[model samples]
Target: MTKKFVTLDDFLGTHFIYTYDNGWEYEWYAKNDHTVDYRIHGGMVAGRWVKDQQADIVMLVPGVYKVTWTEPTGTDVALDFMPNDNKMHGTIFFPKWVEEHPEITVTFQNEHIDLMEESREKYETYPKLVVPEFASITYVGEAGQNNESVINEAPYDGMTDDIRAGRYFDDNYQRIRK
Candidate 1:
């Protein structure tokens, strides 16, 4: 069989709730092919609307999309969304853990300030960090229907398709250096 990938233009919007095996749940919204918004209703960041996460989505198979992005907290995430089976899988690489155990996670830290400098000075680098946590996530439901996790907000208003005007930044715009 031939494998197909989702193109930017052919992309449809994505919104769903998924739960990790540990019972932490998140409501995610793929605002477009390039941006994501989510709310953590459980686990570490409950009740916060994490908006405008830059993401790259690739379709592994029909109804199965892989989304990858870096969070402002220095956390790297790769998630596979399988709506047909009502499941998702994820690997999260956290810099805080790497910061705590340098020997264990000796990999390139990308643009993350503290870890990036450490890796540069030590000359210990790899393309990507070896993720330690594998989260088995199951689809909870769609965005709105009886989901307490949904933040009930419209798509972030500050988003602009004009790349020349401004680069993609989080809702707080902290990533934008003055």
Candidate 2:
């Protein structure tokens, strides 16, 4: 991850252009010095490497999002994206571990994620399979609609307005723990 800490922006409930480029990572080390430099192999064209990216507005909220990817061998996965203060926390629920005891769940902070090889390969491979896919967020509202202003309602406990009402759900969308 480039940044040690990721401060959450206003992307809580708003869907906007989210872009990323993946390429061969090259780290150059000086012959006598340990200092290194990194670059993308095919990152530029002519004199510039136009990075590949997919831009789409993403409304990330605390809830379960289904993963429909190609790769017939790969199983399904769900993500629970939670926004706390300036951090977006996520819990990955792999299909194989959903039913297994001591579920093999992966939890990490989004701010600390790098589109490069820093994060899980799934983060890069899965999304690339589909373009402009709507990432359904679990926002609790009156009639199936959620807004940014509403946080910590049903499955999520808001850190900002002291609105710790309703019970919270785990990464697998289970209310096992409050």
Candidate 3:
């Protein structure tokens, strides 16, 4: 039972832009970090949280075939083949508080974006094709939930990824210079 278009091999070990239904996008890649749970070798999925460009690796289980992340939040975030279609579809989750929705319809494509300050100059701005492709990963919000709460409630400590991303604000709640 093989699917059309992309397959397991084609989707893994490559770079793709993960687009969420709420218009949030991240540059994604993966590596098999040898951790096991329930016989599933954990896959470390690295996603750059584009707002300030911080990349963090999150553990996802049941990933050898269809990359699933359910252990972290007790909510299953899975990636599966889009039936009757050719692209990959699934629920993409970020580290702990970064993503709080049950899940968001995540679409992965061959689209790539280099967040390096120097690399951004290589291409001319094109019309965003990623915007229209985001469909709700959740059955509830067709557009998914807003990410502000997750960002706001996240702890502002030196250990947090958000702190490294320079997303902190002043005592008055104004964004400080990164």
Candidate 4:
């Protein structure tokens, strides 16, 4: 299929619910061209409504699209929506640990999280899969049901750096010691 990237106007007034393999279900409402409101169904922030989160939505195929955004805590997310197949797959990059250690520069070999063999020779590194591609999530319901709640609410400003660092821990060290 030819690649075509469409604008968010195509998705405006749409609502989608997807459940990850890890059992994290999320409800996404496309309010406009730049803003999306989301609610986590099962996670640390469950039931917490994040309103007016800025997002970049692009159509990859006729009915498939890729939506991406960065959270306030420095987390990056990229999700591919496959409505025809009733599936959504994506990856979330948690940069809290890396942010704590500004001295290190982390680079991934690919979206699969494999480390490059050449990089090992250049620097002392313990390669880890920081970005894990999530399994396909089941997409439910039709779009344009107006599932919108009280929109125009305050946008989501994720956790503060220090607090987020405390909650985020890697195998090496905890960034911020409470």
TM-score of each: 0.53, 0.19, 0.28, 0.54
Give the distance in Å from residue 9's predicted Cα in candidate 2 to where it truly belongs.
26
**lDDT for each residue of candidate 2 in 1-178, tens digit (9 for 90 to 100):** 1212122222222221111123211111111111111111222110111111111223333331211221111223222223222122222222322223111121111222252223234332332222122222222212111322222122111321121123333333323333
Q: Best candidate per TM-score, number?
A: 4
Q: Output the lDDT of residue 74, model 3.
A: 24
**Alpha-carbon lDDT, every model:** 0.51, 0.22, 0.29, 0.50
Cα lDDT for residue 37, model 2?
Answer: 14
Return whichever of 2 and 4 wins on lDDT.
4
lDDT preference between candidates 3 and 4, better one: 4
Worst 10 residues of 1 by lDDT: 155-164
After TM-score superposition, the amount by which residue 7's alpha carbon in candidate 4 deviates from its true location, in angstroms, is 8.9
Could you tally the backbone clashes for each prediction? Answer: 0, 9, 2, 0
The C-alpha stretches of model 3 lying farther than 4 A from their native spots are 1-7, 33-65, 81-87, 92-178
Q: Which window of ten consecutive residues has the lowest lDDT sum in model 2?
A: 27-36
Off by over 4 Å in 2: 1-108, 115-140, 143-146, 150-178
RMSD of 2: 19.2
Candidate 2 local lDDT, residue 11: 26
Which candidate has the highest lDDT of all?
1
The alpha-carbon RMSD values of the candidates against the true structure, listed in the order shown, are: 12.0, 19.2, 19.0, 14.2
